[model samples]
Target: MPGVMDIKRKIKSVKNTQKITKAMKMVSAARMRKAEDAMKNARSYANKIYELVGNMADRVEADSHPFLTARKEVRNVCLAIITSDKGLCGAFNSNVVKKTLAFARENKGVNIKLICIGKKAYDFLGKKEFEVLSKYVSFGGKITYDEASEIGDKLVDYYMSEDVDEIYIIHNEFRSTAFQVAKVTKVLPLSIEKTEAAETTDYIYEPKAEVLLKEIMPRYINFTVYFSLLESIAGEHGSRMVAMDNAARNAGEVINKLTLTFNKARQGAITNEILDIVNGAEALNG
Candidate 1:
């Protein structure tokens, strides 16, 4: 068994750790609220644009947009994996990396490349078999639409130039503070669809549907990239908040246990001292 002093030191160390965890939890909580609000607001715009683009794309000819044209063979593929730059966020980054690796394994023969959005993703996947075309990081746990658009421009260029036959974005979609699901979205060779309302509604475009789509398609691409990045930021904050909360609670539990041990050790030392004093007195009297 450890001595009383050692146990006391352990308890003090745990308490210090608990303080850090609590601070991190509080910071993550505050950031989560802002990130979630931004993500939620963007979701509305994302939904609206998705619907608007789908309806417009359906009315236009396939030849009108390169996005509408499907590649004959998907030889080269690009996977854009979004994650947090830092750790201590539970499995948020790992899950996304796992999803990306799974995708690579499933498609064995295809030439796969990478576009990593965070340091974690690049740090992990950069050493892997896939070629990392680009990496963007160091946002300090905060992200903006302008940054997303800049990345989007890179993706647009890659797709338009036929550098990659298909493009997918892997990320964690925020469900709740405690839950996040990794998702892979195929963004290139755009999958245009007709909404339920579009199937029946007959309307004419202000200019021309094809002309409108020509302008709107690129925006849709940018929005998709931006929204995914927002989702990742929100999810990162939520995951980190939960992880830090758990860490703080565990630290408290450890401190409680250590205190108990320290008290027991101190009590044992006191009992031993009393016994020693009584025995010495008896010997002296004898």
Candidate 2:
């Protein structure tokens, strides 16, 4: 049984914690709205770019470009992992890391290259057994297309150099505030269907279709990376908002329980004091 003083102190502490969690929940909720809007806006452009690139790739011979060429065995594979820099977002980062690790484990014999986006991912995968090629940390819980472009540039350079035979991006796709989908996308050797879809469309080229492809293909890759980053940002904010909301609710419940305990303890103390006074008065009078 806790003393009245101790119970009061605990109740006060829990109330303070509840206030903080409530504020955090509100802040994350506001940010989530903006993040989600940004993601939705970018998706249309990303889809357009992919559709155009896929169509263009069809007009030319599949062997016309190295990027469109698919190889039999993947000697080296690069995994671009997007994660949050901070914790307290429930299991957002942990789940992504888990899925990534599972993929890495599944491809045991192949050389696994890592391109980590967040500090958490960099730290988590940077240790032994993983080859971290590049990392970009400190996006400040938000990221922009420019930051995404820099990462895309690094991946393009690596892919063109044939350093990695296959490139895959691992990220969380925003479904709703409560849900996110873990996704792994193949970045290179643009899908055959996308190319065929492009081939069927008829259009007049200004200079040449191949020339346009030279310019557009790289941009397409960049846009794909950028979109993935945006999706990741949206997912992070959504997850954080949901996590903080739960935290606030849990804090409220705790504070309520503690207050109940404090009141009981105080009532017990008062009852004991009254009993002591009555007993003393009776003994003195008798």
Candidate 3:
């Protein structure tokens, strides 16, 4: 059993840790709210852009643009993986890394290259045998659309140059403050699925459908990347908030146990002193 001083030290340490965790939980909660709102606002625009592209593909020929055409054989694949720059979150980064590795393992024959977006992804994948084509880290919690556009442009260049046959992105999709799921989405060679509910009315193109496609398709790809980044950021905050909340609770439990132990130790010390005094007094009197 530890002495009263040792137990007091432990209690103080735990109380300090509890304070830090509580502060972190509050900060993460505030950030999560802002991130969720940003994510919600961007989601509608991203979906509309996707819908517009799908509808346009239906009206145009298959070979209207290079992005609209699918490759006959997939030879090489590129994965743009998004993870948090920092981690205090439970399994948020680990889950994404595991999913990406599983994806790589599942597609053994194809050549896989990585475009890592966060420090976590870059650090984990960098140590592996996988080829990392590009890495971006420490965006300082603020990712701009222009930065996303740069990444998207690089992917487009890779596709156009025949460097990669397919491009996919892996990220954490924000569902709620308490829930997030790892999602993998293909962004290249643009999959066009016809929607039954979409209107069949004919529409006129201003600069011709082909010309407009050349202009807008790249924008669509950029927006997709940007939206994914936003979603991942939101998910990161949510995960961290939950993690810190749990940590604070655990710290509180530890403090309670330590306080109880301290009281017991102090009581035992007092009882021992009293017994020693009584024994000495009885011996002197005898």
Candidate 4:
């Protein structure tokens, strides 16, 4: 049996740890709420833009824009992977990395290049054989449209220069505080599905539909990247909040068990002392 002093010290240490975890949980919860709000606000605009672009693509000929045309042969591929800069989110980064790795493995024959958006993804994918075209590390917590535009511009240059034939994005989609889904989506060569509304609706082009497409397609790409970044940020905060809450709860349980043991040890010591005193008194009387 351990001494009371040792157990007391352990309980004190665990209590300090519990305090830290509880503080972290509260902080993360606050951040998660802010992030989720940002994500929700941005989703409306992003979705509308996406729908407009898709519908426009359907009405226009594939040759009308470079973004609308699919390559006959896919020789090279680029993957833009979004991950968290810092960890502590339970399996949030790992899930994205796993999805990215699975995609890389599946496309074994093609030349694969990576555009890593976060520190964790860059660090993990950097060691791999695939060429890392661009890497953004420690990019802060918030994302801006300008940053997404810059990334989009580089990707457009690559596509126009024939550096890569196809581009895809891997990220986590925020569903709720407790749930996020890892998703892989192709961003380039806009998947133009012919819908009934798209086929029936026809509008006169003021400056030619081709010119309009050229102007809007780049924006589409940039917004897609921006939206994905927002989703990732929200997911990261949510995951961290959940993980920290669990950690605090586990610490509380551990502290309770340790306190019980300490009480038992102290009780046993007191009982032993009482027995010794009683036996001494009896012996003296005899």
Candidate 5:
């Protein structure tokens, strides 16, 4: 068994760690609220645009718009992997990485390109044997629409020029404060099945489906990218907050165990000293 002083030192160390985790938990919770609001506000717009595009695409021939046209054969794929710039968020980053890896293996023959959005993704996938078109990081737990627009523009150019046959966004979808689900969303050659609600509704074209699609298609792509980033940011913060809370709880448990060990050790030492004194006094008297 370790000495009482050693146990005391360990208890102190664990306490300090617990404090840090608690602080992180608080910070993450605040950021999560802010990000979550942005994500929520964007949800309505994203859904409407999604519905509009899907309905319009269904009305016109698929090949009428470049964005809606699918390639004959998928030769190259571009994956935009979104993750947090930092760690200590439990399995948040690892989950996205695992999903991405599975996707790569499933399409092993295809030439895979990468667009790494966060440091975690870049640190892992960027160093691999893939062509990384771009890498973005250092957002510091916040991102603006302009940054997302820049990334969206790059993806647009790549798709228009046939740089990649397909583009997919691999990111975490914000489900709740304690849970997030990783999703693989296709970005290029856009396809959305008409929902029951949308199927019942019919729309009259303003200028023409082709003209509207040509003008609004790029904006749709850019907003899609921006919305994905917002979702990812919110999910990351929620995951981190939950992770830090769990860490703090675990540290508290360790501190309690260490305290128990410390008290037992101290008691043993005191008992031993008492025995020594009693024995010496008895011997001297005898």
Candidate 6:
């Protein structure tokens, strides 16, 4: 049995922890709402841009641009992994890391180059023997379009340089406040499926098809990267918010249980002292 002082100290510690968890839960919930709104507003424009680009690609010959070309032998692959910078989110980082490892395993022998966008992914993959080509972890809690553009520029450079045969983005797409789906979307060599999404009847080019293709092609890739980052941000916030809520609830439970234990211990001590006093008094009377 712990001394009364020890029991009291434990209860005080638990109370402090509970307060912190509750505060964190509130903060996360507020951030999650803002993130969700940003994602929703950005998604439509992002989708329409890609769809328009795809439809234009459909009308033109496949070999009009090099980015549209799909290679037969995939020797080198670039994986752009998106994860949260910090963790407190339950299983958010783990899910992405596990899927990425599985992807690496499945695509054995192909030279895998990693492009990590978050600190969590960078740290997790850095520990492994994988080849990490580039890492961008500067994005704070808020992800801006500039950050996305910078990341996209690297992918474009890699693809244009022929350093990587295929580029894929693996991220958790924001589904709901409590749900996220891990998705791997091919971002380079501009898949025909993407072109199919934007299929249109006829289109007029401001300049020659070649010139327009050159201009629009890179933007399409940049926008895709941007969209992914935005989605990932929303998903991260949602996961964190839910995780914090759970943590706060669990902390409350712990405090409740500890308080009960403290009370029991204190009561036991008091009862023993009373018994001792009573026994002494009886002895004196005897």
Best by lDDT: 3
Q: For residues 1-286, write the lDDT of model 2, one tens digit per residue.
A: 9788888788788778878877887887888888888888987897788667756766777787778888778899999999988777888888888989899889999999999988889888899588899998898878777878788888889988989999999999877888998888998867657433333547899878777777887787788888887777778878887888888788889878988888888888899999999999999999
| Model 3 accuracy (lDDT, Cα) | 0.91
Over the stretch 209-256, how does candidate 3's per-residue lDDT look in tens digits? 899999999999999999989989988988998999999999999999
Error of 6 at 2 (Å): 1.6
Q: State the displacement of the C-alpha of residue 3, model 6, in Å, after optimal TM-score superposition.
A: 1.9
**What do the candidate models score in CA lDDT, each in turn?**
0.88, 0.83, 0.91, 0.88, 0.90, 0.85
lDDT by residue (tens digit), candidate 5, 153-194: 999999989999999999998889888998999999887664
Cα-based lDDT at residue 242, candidate 3:
93
Error of 3 at 189 (Å): 1.1
Give Cα distance to truth, residue 26, candidate 1, Å.
Answer: 0.6
Candidate 3 TM-score over all chains jointly: 0.97
For each of the candidates, the C-alpha root-mean-square deviation to the true structure, in angstroms, is 1.5, 1.7, 1.3, 1.6, 2.0, 1.9
Query: Of the candidates numbered 3 and 5, which has the greater lDDT value?
Result: 3
- After TM-score superposition, what is the CA distance of residue 68 in candidate 4 from its true location, in Å? 1.3
Off by over 4 Å in 6: 194-200
List ranges where model 2 is wrong by over 4 Å: 194-201
Give residue 53's error in model 2 in angstroms.
1.5
Model 2 earns a TM-score of: 0.95
On a 0 to 100 scale, what is the lDDT of residue 88 in model 4?
Answer: 83
